[model samples]
Target: MAYKDSSKLLPPPSANDIISVANALNTLKDVKTTWIIGKISLTPGQQKFWFEACENCQKAINVDVGWVMRCPSCKEESRVVARTRVGIAVDDGTGSINTVIFGLDAEKLIPFTTLQFWEAHTR
Candidate 1:
């Protein structure tokens, strides 16, 4: 399956020096750098990875009747206009990191849209 969206690709490891996931974690806390890791593992339970988030404040929205969602914090009501949020555990042999991908990043990472995946799997 293919997603129908243009995605900005993350820079290649060559452009950003490859580092161990352990080192990446430590340095990330102290400084900012484009550290890359090889052999990323998405882990399991990808079905739970994606969820709906409010478009206005980007917070998780509660689904309501008629395919509508209400944002608790922003108090905004939207009609099925939520974006995808993805959580994954990534490992590069050295260490593992749990990260959440949202917006365009989640769109880029997901090969298929949430609706498409659900429909395909439901049958």
Candidate 2:
């Protein structure tokens, strides 16, 4: 029996693109917080904590849920942190972007230093 060569016909994959995709995928899987490319509309109350934004983007990045303290004066409840567990690539007017799937594992990873503000906020 003669065997046919199947590998020769396939196109070569770009290593850089593969790496980028892998990194994005890994980020989607590991991160537990979901943020969008938008401005912070609400002010932090007594129980509120502000997280630093990205240096380049200047957008509200990661939020510190743990830093949030209870306020006896305002009688406000702690803000619930939301996460993006699944992500799909979306096309904005300018270019492609990532849309987060809400209410998933992404909520759990909010407070870790390893999760940068910009990285957490941006798609």
Candidate 3:
């Protein structure tokens, strides 16, 4: 199979292209991509950053009921930490915003995962 370059498939930059945080925030589209340039800061006094999710479908489980949960999305009975979820503030000169990042992206800013962080601090 021929290895096609993906850069060829992208459209040329348009005037409406999201160039910064302010531009992205002003756009009406529900989803868009842009370079998030800013200093990262954790939300102060924040405790929990992750929740149990269905291993099969990767969705949050019903935690209020406790222990065993039948995942509505996957209909599975088991769940796992799956990954991390974090709330952070980013300021890119033009503006600032609070956003949630998860998985490997979240891991980049944090020194530890949810369980590891809690365990170390609690002990």
Off by over 4 Å in 2: 1-62, 70-75, 79-82, 90-98, 105-123
Per-candidate TM-scores read 0.56, 0.20, 0.66
Candidates 1 and 3: which is better by TM-score?
Answer: 3
Compared with the true structure, all predictions reach lDDT values of 0.59, 0.34, 0.62
- Please, what are the lDDT tens digits per residue for candidate 3 over residues 11-49? 456656536778768762765445466777887766676
Instruction: State each candidate's clash count.
Output: 0, 5, 0
The most accurate candidate by TM-score is: 3
How do the candidates rank by TM-score, highest first?
Answer: 3, 1, 2
Q: Which stretches of candidate 1 lie over 4 Å from their true place?
A: 1-19, 27-35, 64-66, 80-82, 118-123
lDDT by residue (24-90, candidate 2, tens digit) is 4456677632232322122223221223323222223354433343333334444423323333454
Model 1 scores what on Cα lDDT?
0.59
Per-residue lDDT tens digits for candidate 1, residues 1-123, read: 012232423444574477777888888877664455555556567665445555565555556322656667678775544455577676777888776665556767778665554356445
The RMSD (Cα, Å) of candidate 3 is 7.1
lDDT of 2: 0.34
> How much is 44 displaced in model 2, in angstroms?
31
